[model samples]
Target chain A: MKPKLVIPLLIGIAFLLSACAGVGFRSDTSWPGLTSDGDTIYMAFNQAVYAINASNGNLRWSYPAEPERDRTYFAPPAVAEDGTLYVGDFTNGIVALNASTGAIEWGPIQLGEGDGRIVGGSTVTGDLLLVPSGDGRLYARDASDGSAVWTFPAEFNEPLEHPIWSAPVVDGERVFFTSMDHNVYAVDLAQGGQLWATRDLGGAIADSPVVVDSKVLAGTFGNELVALDADRGRKAWIFDAGDWIWGSPAVRDGVAYFGDLAGELHAVDIRSGSEIESWKQSLDSRISASLAISEDRIFVAAESGILFARELSTNEEQWKVPSRGTFDGDLHTDPLVLGDTVIVATNGGDPLLCAFDVENGSERWSFTPGGSDKRCRSG
Target chain B: MNIGEIWDILILNPMINALLYIYDFLGPTLGLAGAFGLAIIVFTILIKVISLPLTIKQQHSTQRTQALQKDPEFLKIQKKYKGDRQKLQEEQMKLYKKKGINPLAGCLPVLISFPIIFGLYGAIIRSLADSPSPLLEFSKHIYSSVSSTIIPLDSQFLWMDLGQPERFPIPALESIPIIGDGIPILAIIVVITSYLQTKLTTPPQPGSQGAGMSQMMGIYMPLLIGYFAYTFAAGLALYFVVSNLFAIGQAVLMNRFKSEPEPAGKKKKKAEEQPKESGVLSLLASTQESMMKLLGIPPKSTTQGSNSSESAKDQSEQSGKKKADAKGS
Candidate 1:
């Protein structure tokens, strides 16, 4: 080739080779979304669910016994009172695993053609497993046999085509949920009938609504935290966040604590939907996970993989745990508060599920899910 | 670090950070979707302005070569070394050295910009990653200044989702039985602008060695860019359209003011008597040529001699026939 032409062609070839080498670019490697039951910490990472000893972070057992192509878990496992762990996967539908043994109890259940991959953890309310799918439908399956109880929208004559991304908040007999269609839906759990849907909030809602008092408080793409009458779905109040809220607000006492995409953590009066002037704080990192509240402290994980623990009342930072392993990953899963230890994990390269002392943010035990550092990725 | 890691740290990361920085400022006022679309246009303009010097040099380099190809002295040397490919290459180098025109200058910029283009592509992908993992990777590149407005970037921009391939915004239009979302408007713009840019910068060289290659690039480049715009994110297609249009405008403006005239001399006058070559060769393959030069790489053309060789053989034949005809007279 002519040298003039050769230069570009060579660069093109180099790029092609680099692209080919990137075939294994696991940029989406699942982070540890933790679920705790007694002494076992059920950690979901990449493509498998692990049961780790809460004390040492040692692998106890893992579901699927190995990572399957269709079983990558991105959502945290929801543990029920009966020790059945309800978990969602990227490709595989919701699965029910024995919490202690990591054994498949009833599922890998298909939710409408099995392609409606679950990205949100299931809500195990009473006898039904409320699994949210990307297809905008919430599938209610029997917790015992994983049989279909009912699927919202599918039961309706004209099924809504919007994705129900956040896990449905089951309040009493009613399930309050948010959809990418930019509305909050309140439906009767048993009959699968939509009781009411609020007016278009002008933005999509990807975070779950917190049922505080009689209001369903949810954050939205329009950078507004809207409070609606939980029973009638009446719009009560709206607080403009000035940035998209990817993480749902955590309500404590009368204040609603939430972080916006701009890294500003706001404390709003849930009753009035107004920001509390003294309680607002800016962390300067993307916060995409719900705030994990424990006792008097509120645990928040940023997309920077840093976990911040602050006093719930004063909004004063107690301690901040810098990202473990590589700082490239995000802590999408809410930090888990188990007694004195707070567990959190990152989602990118060498994802580390680390446990820190809640009081001082001291590292306790860290675990790597997919690496060959330790055995037992499977149960 | 490996090649992939190196690419991310150096090229992809910087592009992502720069684009996001632009997005962060515009997103708040324009809405997330509009912010991304506007950011791409602004970024394209920034890159164009940064490489403006090379753009002017590429134009000057092309014009000088066009003048050289028509010189009688250059043609005489071409005729002398017509049969010997090696001797022709040596003589061409000497001629180029004497004239002080770098044949590679036209293309060095274009070759250099490829990494930036690839980096921009990677940046777009990373920034639009809505999922947790990819979003996490995107966070590492975020500058502290724009760190807060980084996530949940509104993908919806007007009628298109900046993150996904653009489709018709109107439901009725999109539901048009067979057409299904009509055509991608940005992709169409990319194709037209790309073709115009290619035509303006690489106008068909009638009888040069690069004619076939130039013609091939003219068709393929626009089609390739159009295909990407059709299939990839609307934000990327928007970038393509803006950059191509900017280049077409720049080429027109730069070519209007030619570089300082080559000092006139005896050798230059003798060269003016020769038949002017039809094709004006340029290494302005794409916007990337000058970029490559900025990175300190001179993309030399081996075909410099070959392009002239075909014309050299013809000249030799014509001269031989002229002598025979003179003897007959």
Candidate 2:
């Protein structure tokens, strides 16, 4: 063959190989975004937001009706008191859909001129819908009309250097959120005025800040779980987890239960930031999602595709179920517990959402949009 | 281990760490703004330097092939063995051996660099972990030496969110009719630089069978790269532009330092005959002339000087032939 043709051929082959390897030029990937309003659970994954019945796992309705190629829905939807679902897409656009009929209520209103994305779910507090954008601004829009109430930075020109991937948690009058800039910010819920921002937590935070007992608790990739004073944003205490923490700790009573990426689940005293005695369990699988706590049991989803239910008091494993025949069975989103069912979303699995019995490790029902032959089964 | 595992261990992991390390080091010094972009530029240059020897070898092989194609003896052999495929192959091989040229030499370095280029592309994608799942995947590949604090490398470079396809918005163009949306400036630059690189590095094939293929390659490569630049992340597109410029510079430098002097007799004969213009140069000139015509500007008369030179050489040739005829009588 001609030597001149070889380089182009090699480039074409390299691109093909890169595509096959799933390491294409566009580098974004996300797990399903799951949220619940007791009776219905809204799941945002790939192209459309799915509303599934919490009781029977039946499809209520999906917004957009047909999937869009350009738009992707991965942020968990924020449901208003009026039964309007407010969700953001990866294209930096927000839309409000009627919960019952899945009709477009207001928008697809674009934010930041399509430069940034909305990775974290929005929050509906009172009449205000707090949307955390990847453009590093937490926007407070009116829940009724999807109109902008106030932007966090105020100055549109000076935005945060990094994206905000964590949802804003509203506590009373103040709302707290985490940014990839390695800081936790507390802003006024009404006017979007910044109250305070914590000094760099030494690593980026990808999960929402949990406001518990006058302390804002957030896990960071800095290998520690930090507790800051809710008002002043001063560091209250830090619990070293031995590895990067990617999920917010499940706070129950006075203890925060969370797992590190190294698969070690620890129960830490939320007041003192000290680990509880003999309250650490190693699952031998990476845990990148927040733990879900019900009455006495805490559900832990591992990257190895196994879901384990452990006693919250003793950190002892009660029952473990392996999500088999799915795409790696990888679970990366926070699990939601509504009554007897604990629901978790998978990363590119056959069934997008799966629900298991909270009492026993049995599969109750699995929900996959656009029904698949190979359903996700637990063993 | 599987191929994927091996690739991650050897290529992807190291590149990821290198990018993180560079970003971390530059964060404090460079003020944390556009540091990741600077790191990418530095990393690309580092890869180019590491593969310099292979690139130089490829350049030398290309130069030798071009010289062999222009050799009078090789042309005579091709003419003599025109109807015989076996004889042509045998003579070509003999001439190649006598000239100490390896026909396959140019391909080996390109083959070796494929993994590096592909690995770099993967590293850029993995490094710019913009979302959750990608960040989780990226976390597993971090080296112990590199700090986890750099979990999310800054994707902001100038007006670009390096993770997204780049566009430069012009507020002034907003009032205009059609192109009110932001211009894809990076993709345009990618096409231009890719074409320039292909033209500069691709040794001028005059009348060889591969000349048309080479010309087609010059057009297709830029379009392919431009398509990727327009659709993919801006970071990868930035890599393409920088790599193309670096390769073009390297080719020019290699050509300057490594070119052998022509024989005096061949030089004089060449001067008396019509100068052989390279396929790439002529194609570029014609393209420029066509664009000029389309824009209603008459092209500068480039052929006038060449035409006068050809006429003077033709008159000198006729005079020499007449003198030779007189001697024969």
* Candidate number of the best lDDT: 2
Please state the error at residue A141 of candidate 2 in Å: 2.4
- Give the per-residue lDDT of model 1 (tens digit) for B219-297: 7778777877887768777778888888876864454333223325633663565444433323243234434333356
Estimate TM-scores for all models: 0.66, 0.86
Error of 1 at A132 (Å): 1.4
Tens digit of per-residue lDDT, candidate 2, span B270-300: 5677566686764454445433433467546
Q: Which is the leading candidate under DockQ?
A: 2
Q: What proportion of true contacts does candidate 1 retain? A: 0.07
Fnat of all models, as shown: 0.07, 0.48
Which of the CAPRI classes, incorrect, acceptable, medium or high, describes model 1? Answer: incorrect
Residue B186's lDDT within candidate 1 is 87
> In candidate 2, residue A291 scores what lDDT?
96
**Best model number under TM-score:** 2
